[model samples]
Target: MTKMTFRKLLAATALTGITATAVVAEEVDYGKFDGYTLRVKLIGGAQYEPLYARIAEWEAMTGATVDVLSRKNHFELDREIKQDIAAGTLDWCVGSNHTSFAPQYGSIYIDLNGVIADATLAEFQSLALENSTVDGRLVQLPRHSDISNLYYIKSLFEDADNQAKFEAEYGYALTPPETWDQVKDQAMFFADAPTFYGTQFVGKDEAITGRFYELLIANGGALFDDDWNPTFNSAAGVEAVNFFKDLYEAQAVPAGSLNYLWDDTGLGFASGTVALNLDWAGWASFFNDPENSKIAGDIGLVRAPKGSAGIRTGWSGSHSFSITETCDNQAAAASFVTFLTSHESQMVEATAGLLPTRAAVWDDAKAQFTADGNNFLVEVFETYAVSMSEDAFTPPLITPWIEVSNEIWPQLQAAILGEKTPQEALDEAADAARIVMEDAGYL
Candidate 1:
């Protein structure tokens, strides 16, 4: 196995929560744009909305105004941004960007390589900055990173009767799974129809595509060969696809899983019916909140399991902010993005369980969680901080990515639902993806 990769600073501070502040306070010129009403578009959702409350602070600091043109979820926002790009009406100055979605925007956003100060960029994890770059230009400043780990019900694993039954039946101890196959066995074992389920997954759209991509890599498959030819129809790919198909066919996941997305899966786990959920850290607080979660005090987490190749299934990205290339006030826009992703702003977001892109905040936030005796969150940070740095990787950074994804995900859903065999489905999707790449001049 490969040596575990992680940010040295984070690994050194693990569990102990020894506070060592890495972000140096620096005075930044929040350039004066007193009368400027900077129009912006953003991704809207519950976990993301809390950070907007801090926007007023930036407005006050800069003596400028923000005119939010729209606040829709990412899919809607993506369509609008594409329309804006095509219509040459990028009137908005700033917008939300993600590592997976940014490549599709091409040159619509300004390159921040020369705009953001080097010292400020230095504070962020280098991998995040690298992921934000497209064609060697810094297109976005990362706000928070995303990666999944397994979340399970502690009580289920601790029941003596259940343990004995699982051991006798599966020839192994009943515990949090260490591999995808084991997850399947355990999920099938714990399933109890409409009352409870073993686990759930985001079943449709790019969400499922991303899930499949990571598992494909885990099972020793690649989406594309070095020459950009679609190669996800390999045996490894079949294994990955079958994992999901098996769970759905066995009724281990929810019945409506085919239509579910992040919210559905997160809420399903919190409802206490789902025993295992592979999810991002952003939902940690919500999953543990007494008022919101039925399993509030009974959650357990483990690093995402390995596939046949001994690699964890880690499909990762970041939510970020970017300035438009056509902005009327680039300086003001730059200052605003910097302020939004600043150390203090990140601290606020991280405290509520979002994984920080800033390396230093990992230590600072874990320290605070430790001081509060929140061992759960402390362990969460430790596990995710390593995953973010070591295992996290973005989709193929190319302009036709989203277009390619639109073709692949539906085919994936069809295969999972038994509309086609995994091989047949992947072969059809690869043929379509090949045309996409060829039309984009990649092949």
Candidate 2:
């Protein structure tokens, strides 16, 4: 089936959780917002656009109108929101948010704990809700969780010639990698550059910084010491940075990888030229549908590989919604966000492979995939579910996280591009991070 068809079919499947266990089907109410125009700024992308399709339903039910002031990718949307904050023009009622980015917004967003009903909050996964809280404020309502696992072309590992060749050279049978070291070895081995490469990463911005952070944590490193002093320049940090540097040096990843982000990495893997991709569940169907992926039906997956410390790399967060503190219509804004993250709405998103923030949707999504005979998606959820629960963690949830990340990524890029040694790059980044932490009163 085509990728588009798969999505449409999934949405129509009527899997469980039309009303989650904690949600009152008819007892609780979505307050009337008649004639109230709830202005919002949203994060836009193919995977996220479908949920917006239900906006009319909410409008009809509440007799209100939604004014989407802007729709841009998360990075651009974040920049725009910051601009609004600086200009003191937070006229919009709702905006898109992320766990990694919410802290920086501070008091600009109101605490949702009081605005949203406690019963509604109870419907979400406790861990996700906990992560959404920053400095004791429930600033955002999680739309969907984000966590990654490894995806590879299964056919390559199944080839008799390839398996024998790999076994002869590495003294082990060729299979999906179970550790970061094996990933490097296999990626380097499979790379036939200009035609095919072994793996790729989102190499710039907080994208790279977050990647480095998770790998650092997997190697038993922390970004800060007990007193909140910068400590990522430790030996573990050097090791983490070297992994990317070595890949770039060996041409195991794309030549233009340093410029890539999530979209670039997702599309690169779908093009069938990359062997292993660490990606979120949102792309599971896209990567397996012949209409969108050249390697469709040839995909394999596993939990993200472990670092030297035996911990898996599971950097995670959520795409979410928030209400502005300056809003004149907080009640309307609250209702709108609640409806957007409702069980039925989340079910629509989950059908398209986005992980749910509500705990019940996990089992429902898996059961639906099983009923549809989609073993790949079933495995994707199973693997990601475990990784998210056991290995997933966020970057430091502090006001200066983005500022600190900005200082670190450039140095990380320089190291990966061979302009600086890994130790030198991390040392510089650590110095810059220390300044940011100190400025934020963390040091």
Candidate 3:
């Protein structure tokens, strides 16, 4: 299907509401704010927009109007927020936030500790709430949490002819890859290039840098030492960089991968050309929908694979809502955020395949899927829950994380595209990361 039609279908599928009784049994008492306008700046995207449609419910319940002042992608929104800080234009009461992006805003957002009820806070997963904290302050209410797992074409492993050829060449039985080494071997084995690639990766900006960071962790290396000194130029780091370089050198991944991002990788997998893709739970419904994917019935999933150090690569973050400290209506803002993250709202998102931050929603959504006979999504939730609970880790919650990412990814592209050896590239990246750490007063 065309991207436009696919998005429309997703919007329709996502906006289907559950019963009001299923949402909240005890009504929220948001006093009265008849003439008040609760201004918000939310992330606008196909997956995120449907949830905004429910803002009307919040307005109606509390006699307040929600004025969405700005709607942009995260990067654009981040820039706008920076400008807002610099110009003293944070007039909007609430804004979209991420765990990685929250620390940079300093004291602009309110500490949501006592604003949201203890019961509500207790309902969310502890790990997600912990990630949302900055300087011991709970600054954002997590909307959803994300970490990736591998998706591949099941037929590639099950095909007798392909299996026989793979076994003959590699001297091992072909199955879903359990390690990055096996992933590489399988990718190379399945590759045909141009017409079909073995795999693809997010290749620029924080996307590539985040991918590298997770791999570095999985290989027993880290971005910084206890002193906050850059330390990712180690042997483990070299192994991590070479993984991407080797794939590019063999033409196992696409030539245009350096220009690709998450959407590119998702659509590539859905097109049935890529042999393997590591992506978030958000794409599970899309990847298995016959209307949107050529590989709909043939797809297979496995938990994210391990690296040389035997740790699973689970770089995670949460999309969240934060109430600004400057807001005149903290109660109304809290009400809106609470409603958006309610069990019903989360169920709406979960039905469309977005992972939930609320623990109860996990079982409720899975049971709903099972009852509906959506075995694909059933497996998707079960697999992702383990990763979200035990395997997931976030980058150090520091302001310069994005700045460090900016310096690292361009050099990463240069290395992957053959302009530098993996060691040389990582050394350069380490030096640049040191400069960032120093500038942030962490040195």
Error of 2 at 110 (Å): 1.1
Order the candidate numbers by lDDT, best to worst.
1, 3, 2
Score residue 356 of candidate 1 by CA lDDT.
87
Off by over 4 Å in 3: 1-31
Residues 389-436 of candidate 1: C-alpha lDDT, one tens digit per residue: 667777888999988888888998999999999999999999999999
Q: Of the candidates shown, which would achieve the greatest TM-score relative to the real structure?
A: 1
| Candidate 3 worst ten-residue window by lDDT | 12-21
Error of 3 at 13 (Å): 31
1-443, model 3: which lDDT tens digit per residue?
32234334433322232222245523656556787999999999999988888988778878999999999999999999999999999898999999889989999999999999876776677778878988899999999999999999998889999899999998999999999999999999888988898888999988998899999999989888889988888999889999999998888898889899999999999999999999999999999999999999888999999999998899999999999999999998998899899888888899989999887788789999999999999999989987786568788889898999888899899888889988898899889999888989988
Task: Give the better candidate number (1 or 3) by TM-score.
Answer: 1
- Candidate 1 regions exceeding 4 Å error are 1-23
Instruction: Summing lDDT over every window of 10 consecutive residues in candidate 2, give the lowest-scoring window.
Output: 9-18
Cα lDDT computed for each candidate against the true fold:
0.88, 0.87, 0.88
Q: Where in model 2 is the C-alpha error above 4 Å?
A: 1-27
How far off is model 3, as Cα RMSD? 7.2
What's the TM for model 1?
0.94
On residues 223-293, what C-alpha lDDT tens digit does candidate 2 reach at each position? 98878888999999999999998988899999999999988999999999999999888889999999989
